[model samples]
Target: MAAHRARRWSLGGFVLLVSTAVVAAFAFLTTGPSADRADAATTALTWSDEFNGPAGSAPDPGKWTLESGGSGNGNHELQYYRDSRDNAALDGDGNLVITARKNTDTGLRCWYGPCQYTSARLNTARTFTQAYGHFEARVKVPRGQGMWPAFWMLGDDLGTAGWPSSGEIDIMENVGYEPGVVHGTVHGPGYSGGGGIGASYTLPGGAAFADGFHVFAVDWSPEKITWSVDGATYQTRTPADLGGKKWVYDHPFFLILNLAVGGDWPGSPNAGTAFPQTMTIDYVRVSASGGSSGNGGATRTGAVKGIGGMCVDVAGASTADRTPIQLHDCTGVDAQKWTLGGDGTVRALGKCLDVRGASTTDGTPVQLYTCNGTKAQQWAYTSARDLTNIGADKCLDTKGGSSADGTPLQIRTCTGAAHQKWTLA
Candidate 1:
């Protein structure tokens, strides 16, 4: 990800930190309607890093390879990348904090100039690499001049093909100058650096990204990649979208995270720039898209009619986190459409029908949440025609057992009542 002193700009659904410990950190996602259109739980949890260790601890050495150097990355960045705990460590608050601090030692120098700052760069080069999948990170970025933080990937064959020929996929790149805008770009032999093909997504309502943690993700398939922020897809790029350029993203690629200062894209830091700037990463996860393979179970879709003929609906056709999944008049709309996946998940609006907070207590209202392949989202069809969430062994019941239209739904003990009986057809 290269940058020039450019003008300030302005730019996934796969358990958006819904765990009880971190739900509030992601409350901003439930503010508006979402447009998640995932067909099923196609992506399987292939790898992840929850950073659930004590404060000042190092990251999982088995999964991450710390990179240290002041090579400037060929961009004249001022940070001398360090592999120590001072630069990267767990915050004991369920986060991995990567700090960039002022380095006063004038003796430390880079190939281009003196290193005035020190930061961290981490990669999964030796441990994890996949050809295609949904890659994501929940990150709260820091703001100030010359701060360039990125979550990106490079072809696994980097040692052989080198630089542009090896290919690069920048899932998320943010420059402090443009706090509200993030970028997604692909670099290849013919189009690298400034000429790379990609686009920028600006947060709505002039919201600065440094305000909170937001999910940055990319759904990578064989022929295309779709970028989304907080489950809303903003841009998509495919081989056809390349405009005749080479599409070098056909093979495996590994992940990388780094914080750099004083790059070509974002100029040097000014007086207002703060030292000890930190980027907090909630988690990094990858899910492999369950392609056209007829494996998990035949993907089935239809209306799930329950008591009083009310159909289960995702509120307002929204797929956002915490959106209510209630019983409503059957309109046969997309929001009312439901799918039963082989993975034992009942999906709607590209999200799974989840018991709120995985609560097993009676009357716990159900909601639409990102499909995290958790038992809380899994539903099994019983011989009694009742849909039981495997996680809690509770039936999908109509609230109050009422037959009235627009009645809400919740999880209750499987009493085999008429209200719990559902027909998927």
Candidate 2:
């Protein structure tokens, strides 16, 4: 983690409190589409760690690199991370237990003299990285003030891009003081440190997360990322939510797990804080979209309805290159049957939905062309119901927002208007 990572602040009274416009943007960014969990459940398992090692054994070295130091991980945390089974070990019962204890004998020197606590931090930076998919972990967090546990990720380009430019995704983070809530956040340039974009999910009826294991996850794709707790989605973020800032999560990233004591965000553990608190992890898994590996899954075939409940039809059902795509009545014909494919192509009449001339200009006609794995043909049907061209970063729209039959489709700046909203089956 970098110096500006995961250091959130209270918007109400903190020195980092953002302006009113930013606050309003935050509110809008956190709002997500409904039925997100149902959509996420369809992914196929791709990678996982069950922690089935012998009791008291170290985690599989091939899968994890135990980070050791008193650097505090740029959070001004108190704990000295030790790469020892005393701090992290697999219990006989199929769980990885990370224990944070009051330090006494080790005498590890931290930035502020001797360290007061010892814990563990582990990452998969050396073994694995994935671009887009579903990442999840089942965890029972530790309680008491000053305890911070998280399952998160950093972009693989960290060495080159650096910090926020490399991007970060915090799937789940919990501070002991907020026993009933956990947060999911994304850090990028202009939105690092206390300004990271995210939202919190709280358990119902004031239930404490430490009371039982809960599944925390993120369904991520090129266009959007949805965060969930126990299969219930709380937030979904997209490039449109970035307020013109860059979206840096399109590349592969590696995972990390850590427990820190007394950080700047959580403050130093008080007299009431207990030592030797343990965070138990049952499993961590990753799945690919559409029940298949790679960018997405099996092709989904159906009518892609747009404004006025019209289907996106291939003009004249022609397989010829450069055929225009238009809006027409929903007739269930092959011309109206579009295939949302694994390679991010929208296909009908055996051709791909492409931005004409590979242009990024507004009002560029969206035509059907021979499928070529080019950015011009890539599309992401976002949770906001906008069919966005990956190359243009624009939405599919009917010309002049008209609903008349044979109205040609084009790529334009996304405005969340009715004409840009699509319903893909």
Candidate 3:
């Protein structure tokens, strides 16, 4: 898929540049942290649009803003986006249909002079913005040589931060040529345009996505963002994957849905490409962490006991940064008292449980670091009893899986081993 581009218009019609291109493919992974924790964690509905309005009605004005223009959207796209029902409307069947049609009689001018196509773009920029949660949509994508449909998001601070600095997250994007595959990507300062980090999810048996509706979603947290198709995870991007580039996704972002007829990425529609292609959206929903008030929902203060009932200890009761965390006899001491904060940090002695150097390599020692708001300090306690480092996607384990006192703790691939299990008590 081509890099997804973003466009923001001002009174003077000036457009800010925001583009995305997938530079690397992430390895496919299993379900995210919350996927298996239904009995332990819950998600509360934050916002939703079922598209259940009367036939031919516009989208709920209170929820979506129709973006109409023809400035090429910074990607040299050919469609003249319009606010008319001819381009977007409800089918009276609980679906929002966004249609792209060949129309030269509208007298609308595009970046390439006379506009040859018309389409619709909708966004929630003025209505809703969320920081960390689950965002999802069910949709049936359009098909043809130049069809490019997407469900994505942009940082809420776009007006001030501008383009790449504001950040972008593409939950789903599909080009006509790749019928069986869809992509998810993230764009930031050094990774914008063709340098975005992303990955693809292909349907089994080469089934075309246009044939039916598929669910696209992302579970976002302070340190990680996981993408899924039909409830199956395809990729997870963390600060560790950004090569030291700034991780600017720590704030709120809004949503966008659009179908373009042609663009610099997908090229123009071919002679065989028929007109009036439609992308059908069944619903769009957002949910917040259910059990608590902050990011990960659960906040508890106590000792995090691990293998053989040993507590996770801050070495030598130190409050200094870089203090090694170890598995030691449970003493209920301050150094062994860990607070799993709602903001995703596991804190003790005024510091956080951190993966030293933010390293993703196996055996990287876990330590007590002064909280820096980086992924290294972000941790998620799962229902499986694993303390997962969001950046490394690994679990806290006793070195050598030993239960001996003073055994150092480190991050290792999550294996559900006895040594990786912990009890917040």
What is the clash count for each candidate, in the order shown?
A: 10, 0, 1
lDDT of 2 at 216: 98
Tens-place lDDT digits, model 2, residues 1-425:
22234542211212111111010000001112434323533544444688997999998775677777776656778888888999999998999999999888556987688988999988765544566878999999999999899999877666556677878899998988889989899999998888888999999999999999999999898899999999999999999988999999877777788898888777789989887899999999875565333233433457899989998999887766788999999899667876554457676543578899999999999997755558898887767988889999999999999999999999999999999999865
lDDT of 1 by residue, 302-418 (tens): 688998778988878775688988888898876787756555667654457899999899999999886555789878764467889888999999998887766878999999899
List candidate 1 segments past 4 Å from native.
1-41, 292-425
Which candidate comes out best when scored by lDDT? Answer: 3
- Can you list the residue pairs that collide in candidate 3? 3-20
Candidate 1: 10-residue stretch with minimal lDDT: 23-32
Ranking by lDDT: 3, 2, 1
Instruction: Please tell me which predicted candidate would have the highest TM-score against the true structure.
Output: 3
Off by over 4 Å in 3: 1-41, 291-425
Q: What stretches of model 2 exceed 4 Å from their correct place?
A: 1-42, 291-425
Error of 3 at 17 (Å): 13
Q: Compared with the true structure, what per-residue lDDT tens digits does model 3 show for residues 1-425?
A: 23554432321122321221111111111122444333325564445788997999998765677777787877788888888899899999999999999885667988789999999988866545667878999999998898999999888667668777888899998988888999999998988877888999999998999999999999998899999999999999999999999999988787889998777677789998988999999999876554522233533556889889888998899766688999889988768876564556676654568899999999999998755568887777766888899999999988998999899999999999999999877
